[model samples]
Target chain A: MTMALAGWLSREAAVIAVPVISLAFGCLVGYLAQRSGFCSIGGFRDFFLFRHTRLLKGYAALVIGAFAAFLVFWLATPAAFEHFPWALTSGLSPVPGAPAGLEAAAYIVLAVIGGIGVGIIGVLLGGCPLRQLTMTSEGNLKALFFVIGMAIGSVIFSALVQGWVVSVMKGIAW
Target chain B: MNKEPEERTSARALAKTPVFVGALVGILAAAVQGLLASAGGPEAYGFCVACHTRDLVNSAVNALAGTSLTVAPISKNAVLPFLTIVGVLIGALAAARVNGEFRVKKGSLTSYAWYAAGGVLFMVFALLMGGCPYRVALRVGYIDIVAVIGLAGIVAGIIAGTKIAVACVERGE
Candidate 1:
């Protein structure tokens, strides 16, 4: 449907419009998310700190709703999962299990480190990327600074820390 | 204080419900993000906050410095007049306008440092994780097992952070 619509417009317009359309989708989602008070860390934090589950229910809704949407889209077009397509217990699949050998161990370690790191920071900052965007849009200086830090951190990771990470992984194997 | 008329719209009334609003946004996000994911768009490109926004900032920095230090791909080649972040900003701006929720508050430098530190932690480790918390959900929707593991870690980390927050609140007493 999107491609078909894009075909009518000029090439340049189509190119320019896709990202905008994508952002528009994100915008609607972000706006709705903010208005509804759905946040990533807020959900878990509420459940933990206040024993509140309203936000957690929102989180659950996000998960189940998004998963069902993905399944529907996927059933129509299986190629979207080409990078790492979902398997329905297809025993002859190539994707490795998480409990395997050294590579699996490395994945586990990285996944653990990555999740804990983002989770803590997300809780501290009071929002994830989506929430941050909402805050920044509302002209929150703190959110903007957090974004600045994110930019710096991303640059540092790409330019320097990525190499260090590779070395650390190599060391783990050695 | 009586609010502005637009601020009291039916949309706002409907949005107060977490489950309904959440499901609507989820379905909306998933439709675009999931389809694009298969249509050969960027990885998790639909609604990634860190990657898209960071890429925009990086491009601006590079342009100002007269360098092209692209550590990742961007939507520059697309026909959009600006980065996707711009779209988000506009969307958010509009929402804030409607909700009358725009506010700019700066905290003490100590808090700024704390917030920035948290940002660093988030962006740095998210790169390692290959996605942020939302992206983790997106990946899990695709049945990526690695993301499921990351979700566990996120739970643990949230628990740890919650404990710390509680401790700090108690200490302030």
Candidate 2:
């Protein structure tokens, strides 16, 4: 089958196939996320607000599953090591296009500020972006709006503040 | 312990199962991601909620600027996170269905608006921080100390939000 298909398409087609498969996988996972009610933000919110933890369990399950898959892939496939390098350094010189390394202190500050926003918004929205997607699949019309809003927000951040981000990051210590 | 009615499982019990399951799932997802990364894919990340969010951001900016660049390279990376998210939805839907918890109820218009606004806020923060709550936790599990700080911030934020929410509820405003 591989030989027959190879004959039909160029080498580029074969390379593109990986992403095609990945998209299909993404859609399937999106569907599953919609069904599962597994939002990390939601899990934390519930724990604090209602003292519930069902959503947290689902989160745990996903992490466990991914870890197991990683270990197996690592052991069985020599190529896997290449993808998961220990220190992601590509030669003594930093990659030309790589973002400047921000200071650790800056990272902490940004993370804290951003995290607060994320937490508050997530709770207000009843879930995180992942949860919103999952909720949409489960037939929550509201979540659809949330997704749209997220897209819009992403646009706003990138278009308006990317320069600022680069500058801020550059000024910070790595 | 006193047994409540059959329909009433304690919150504590319900919480335990899901947390356990979520942690396990998270670990598994990370492992697969690591493997995929090692196999000539991205490094130190197989799944990143915030990175994808940035991709979305980039795509949108390019589109508005009339550039040919696609904002989200969703098609170019390990999309397992997207899949896992979908899985959660399906799982939730199935659970809701079986438990007779499925309801087509509508919340207040104000509530819906708030939710949308909140989503926007989340996107902004996620892009700024370079990861979402799930990614933060996953990074922590992988022993990324930086992620631990993010997690701490997230928890602190949650506590603050909860308090504010309670205050709002009490005020009925």
Candidate 3:
């Protein structure tokens, strides 16, 4: 396949392939997500407001489905898991608890603190970025606010807050 | 843990229950994302919203800056995810069209601040947490521990944010 595409994009065919493939892949994910009505915010909202969890069950479907898929793929091609960490590579590594001392402390502090804020804000916002993107395309003009907000918030974090978080964590531990 | 049974309120029959659909979505995600990875997309690029959005923001910023800054280096050399987003829009448009749900419903000004704040918070904490809910799932797919830790915080944050939102609503602010 690489050899076949090399005719047009040269060695850069992989680069060209990324966008085309990403679009096609995204189309499938979005279509499925839409049909399944899978969304974190909607799930949480349903749980909180109306005591519904079927959408949240959709989340369960995602986990099991993705997990099985990754496991089989990894078994077939072990090389993929070799480069990255086990988890990213689709191999599970037991992380039962935090590391020892300051590093553990730092990890807990940052992770828990950041997670709380994100979860709450995400619920308040009514969905995450992916859902918002789905909504934007589906004709929710209100979701555009979220798309812009996510970009602005992320830019600020990348340009500013992320550095501060790293420095603070480093100062506290590793 | 038991509450009122959820109604099949949606127009669709399997409306309330995720059942096989969630797994189906997952299968599709894993297959396509894995195939894309084999084709050269980053492994981390598999079903990520937080990372992709941030990368796009940085890329746009870099293009606007016209000069490199001392900020962190996080963007993929190519902006493949933007196309992925476009594909999402297209897919969503098609899906909504098929459902007869492709119409816009304008919201009120009273909810504007809420919406904006929601966006701001989504970005900031997603950055701090290193992933959003879906991205965290991706992290779990990678078995990343930081995501595991952050998941707790996310639940807490949802509670706190919900409380604040409720108070604001009660006060009519």
List the RMSD of every prediction in angstroms: 5.6, 8.0, 7.7
Q: What are the Cα lDDT values of the candidates?
A: 0.65, 0.55, 0.61
Cα shift from native, residue A165, model 1 (Å): 0.6
Top TM-score model: 1
Q: Which digits, one per residue and each the tens of the lDDT, describe model 2 over residues A49-163?
A: 7888777657655545554554555556534334222213232221111123555556666777887888777776677777676566556778867776776776666656556
Candidates' TM-scores? 0.81, 0.69, 0.77
Which sequence of candidate numbers ranks them by lDDT, best first? 1, 3, 2
lDDT of 1 by residue, A31-148 (tens): 6766776687788999888899987887777767777876776566545433424445322221221112235457667778988988887886787777777787787878877877
**Decreasing TM-score order of the candidates:** 1, 3, 2
State the lDDT of candidate 3 residue by residue for B124-148, as single tens digits.
7766655567656655555566666
**Window of ten residues with lowest summed lDDT in model 2 chain B:** B73-82
Candidate of highest lDDT: 1
Model with the higher DockQ, candidate 2 or 3: 3
Which should have the higher DockQ, number 1 or number 3?
Answer: 1
After superposition, which runs of candidate 3 have C-alpha atoms over 4 Å from their true positions? A1-13, A83-107, B1-21, B38-44, B67-75, B79-82, B163-173
Displacement of the residue A59 alpha carbon in candidate 3, Å: 1.0
